[model samples]
Target: MSYLMMFYSAFFSTSVSASETAATANPMRSQVVADLVEFLIEAGQYLGMKLEQGSMSYQLFALGSIFLVAFASFILAKLILHFKVLRLVSRSNNTWDDCLMEAGVFRRIARIVPGIVVYTTYSLFFEPEDKLYSLLANFSAIYLLFTAWRTLSGSLTAIENIYSRSLLAKKAPITGFIQVTKLLLTLVLIFLLLSLLLGKSPIYLLSGLTAIAAVLLLIFRDTILGFVAGIQIAANRMFNTGDWIAMPKYEVDGEILEIGLNVVKVQNWDKTISTLPTYSLTTDAVKNWRGMTESGGRRIKRSVYLDIHSVSFADAELLEEWEGMKLLNQYLKDKKQELVEDRKLKEIEETDILNCRRLTNLGTFRAYLTSYLKKHEMINQDLTCMVRQLKPTEIGIPLEIYCFSKEKNWVAYEQIQADIFDHVLAILPVFKLRAYQRVSSHNEQAQKNAQ
Candidate 1:
């Protein structure tokens, strides 16, 4: 306890001497604080306590006081911002202010208050020649720089939030660009921070770092590529969020969730997440279904095989039966009239069915399918709707139905396509045509036994 008292006496005496000198040399130093220190030292000495002047303890005390003042100032700033600034922001009807607050822009801005306080008042606690003063000044500058970085970063976040609500965001997402800007800002901050810590100019450090440019390139190869690719993507307006992209090479087929600086996130149809480097979007061959989506229709290109043996000329009875059908009524009338004119033009007799331009059952079936698609509610009539026959394969003749569906949704499109094919297959027997199917051994044996 006695040693502690002596230490206090010596510390106060040193503080008093240093404060007096500081007050005389620097007009900005607080005279009242210096007088308080002097009075404490004089009172302790008058009470028969041994005292000394100008000790290392005084410098330590001044440095400690500067840090203490900075801490207290930070708390006070927070209290003021919470009660005054934050309340005002919250009560306002502005959406921008709300975004800024939510992103902590104001909070991060308030962080500089302590650094400012320390910077402005450091001289009051230490002289111009004091090493502690230089140290505090450098520290406060770095602190302010960091606070500025945080505030700016938060502001960028707020900007992104504001942009996300706009209609254009869906078509032209700026996330990659924003991330690139943030990365550049972070690099600048790092350089500045390094300059301050090393007591060197940023230009000098940048020049020195040029020697390691190759090493830096190797380290940030992906980042550089992504940055370049991001620029290309934005400039070209290739794809955006919610666009369905298929990259078979990567086994990725999904909607884009996010386009970031390093990677793009995809939410697959199966609810699984896929991540690919942003550069890959530029380098890779990806199919964007946005055109199909924007066209408001999805194509259905599928073929149904038919037994070639079932293809025969339409006889009189079959022609009469198809003529009565409502869907084929007008079609048959036009065809019969055209056939009569054609047979007259070529001087061919109707009794000579082999030489006449008569319609085959396969051709009639194809015509019926075309008319059915034209009248179907789900098929888009404005687009190319066709039923064409392809070359015969070993299996059968390929009768392909190519059309766009009114319903572009996957499930709805599938249902529409299934309904069309179901109707076609069921009505095939009416035309006396068979959908070709490979006969299984069991069916062949059963047929033989039945015969």
Candidate 2:
């Protein structure tokens, strides 16, 4: 090409001089993009095609170049990433790169290349003062804005996935923070996109919107409250996904499925879903069993009613009978020693039951229960374990058992509680104690006697 150009220049020096003068004489041609376009038009003239600056053909060529630039740039960017970068990312051992690729971060980033082509090469396709430039620039601005927004969103997701691998994620999850950032970015981008469409400054529109601040506040009241609640919940580590929360007011007794800005979803024990406003968690009282679960124990709080008349001081015969029962042998010995020492110190008459400290059926039963709970394998001995008698009600005296079960799971914990109560109910008669039960009808009396 250089040799041919030299031969042409030597043979047509006069013509070349005349052409150079004509080109240099024109003041309208300054930029390299415009000069290159003019050179293409002149070359088209030699090829039997009419391409002039102010003609319809020039306009058609410019429009055609816009389409070609946009389509080609977009397609080329996609192909490069799809065939090269994406394939490599997919096969790499490093998982973070794969996360970005799957989140569409890299894909959206590739699209920016096309935007750069369309935006920076504006003069190559259209004149600076052309009306088409406004249209093309606006289109590119919107596209770039959307692409940038998507890239940021995808990046946030990738960051979340990366952060989730660490142990601190459960203690203090960054998901709520990430969501707030994403929401703020979305709002900002929306304003910018609208401003580009309407040919107005975003700050101007934002200032004008202040007049309707009250209306917007009313419209987004719940959202604003929810946002505040979400931040507090996350910062304070109030609750998290998979936490067992019981909110009686909402009839929510289940594991949390998700925590969002405006709502929290809980999957109930029956598999139904309950959605509560995020702000409700902050305002309402909720029982979070996460502490119990983390402690590896579940509380067992229950009371058994016993016939009041059946409770009495143990006489000699009763003590002799109870001596054979191994569970009560040590307890009886301990109490006898304690009462004898106390009675001698106070000079109380042993014959008088009121003056002397003697073992009662209720006291013996309470001691037996406390010892039983302490030795039970299913009970958590390291934690609070006690069996105390509560105040007598209209029916009978209430024997309350408060302890912790080793099992934290709902089903297993319930089974442990039931087994303990069932055994206690069955053995009550051994201590001459009867459970309080009211016969609702004659048929109920017969059925109870038969059982």
Candidate 3:
């Protein structure tokens, strides 16, 4: 292009001199000179010419140089990523890169070098106005953006893994928060790409969103609600991953498996999974077994019916007999002495049982139950342990045993409860008390035959 520049300079100088000295300078001469230079340059380009023709074969040398540079860059990046950086990362005990590997972070990052090579070399191969160069550059940019996105996603996943492995993360999970941040990052990247492609300011596009705020809210209502609820749950320590919770509204009676932005997953005892909206945990009433679990006890609240007819005041003979029984010996002795002293002090008639506070067989049974529970190895003595009688119904008097069992496991707790009831049922007759039962036809027939 230097030869053309020299020829144009001389031609333009001559034209200026002729215009100063002559009546008219020929515009056709200037036009002809310009056209001849343009033709020569075009002919040289078609013949694969260079400014210094003998210095190097332009196309061959330029193409080879571009290829070599691109190939070298690719090899260097590959070597750095695979043989050097990744190998070093793999050897380290730190789990951060291990998580990255698991999440495919390095693999995504490895694409960046090749993408840069293609982007740089494509421009060297074709002119700026060429469609092929533009297409290649655009594709390279897209690939680079995609790789960046993938790396970002994988890095976020790696961060989540790292957080989950931490002690604090186990106690207060940040999975939902991490996920929401990832989603926001993804959206921002998408907007940035659009802005880049449209050659418009991102701020301008964002400002346009003011009119669609309501639509955005509607679209992300659940996510927004769940994000708020997740924060509340974590900050308040309302629930944890392993907490056994029951939400009848959602049919979830199970241990919490995961809490996410939009949903909470539960794995039930029956091996069924139940998913509940994250906001439901904050807004709705759900039973958390955390209290019971933390207390190290499982409650046993059940009752056995006592036949009303079998309940009677214990006479001296019956009291003496109970005093000989090992389990009730000390209790009966103490009560009998108390009763005798009370009767003597009140000057009550000994034969008139209603005149004194005499212990009934049912009362003795209740006392026995309280003592039994207190002495039980499987019962939690630190809590409210009691044996009380509920109001009598037509069936009988409900003798309720309210206590906490040592075992929290369902099977073990049930066994312990059953064992206590079994002993109670078996020993009831020893106190001259009978458990209430519906009279059957066989018993009626036997009584009639006896009569």
Query: Among these predicted structures, which one has the highest TM-score?
Result: 1
lDDT tens readout by residue for model 1, 359-421: 889999999999899999888888889999999999999999999998989999999999999
Prediction-by-prediction clash tally = 0, 0, 0
lDDT, candidate 2, 232-290, per-residue tens: 98789998887899999999999998887788999999999999998999999999988
Candidate with better lDDT, 1 vs 2? 1
Tell me which residue pairs clash in candidate 3.
none
Residue 13 of model 1 has an lDDT of 28
Which ranges in model 2 have alpha carbons more than 4 Å from their true place?
1-31, 38-49, 91-94, 342-355, 440-451
What is the alpha-carbon lDDT of model 1 when measured against the actual structure?
0.82
Off by over 4 Å in 1: 1-65, 128-131, 440-451
Candidate 3 structure quality by residue, lDDT tens digits, 179-290: 8988887776676567557656556777897899999899999999999999999999888888999988878899999999899999999999999899999999999998
Candidate 1, residue 161: CA error in Å? 1.9
The TM-score measured for candidate 2 stands at 0.83
Global lDDT of each candidate: 0.82, 0.80, 0.77
Q: After superposition, how far is residue 283 of candidate 1 from its true place, in Å?
A: 2.0
Candidate 2: 10-residue stretch with minimal lDDT? 8-17
TM-scores for all candidates: the values are 0.85, 0.83, 0.79
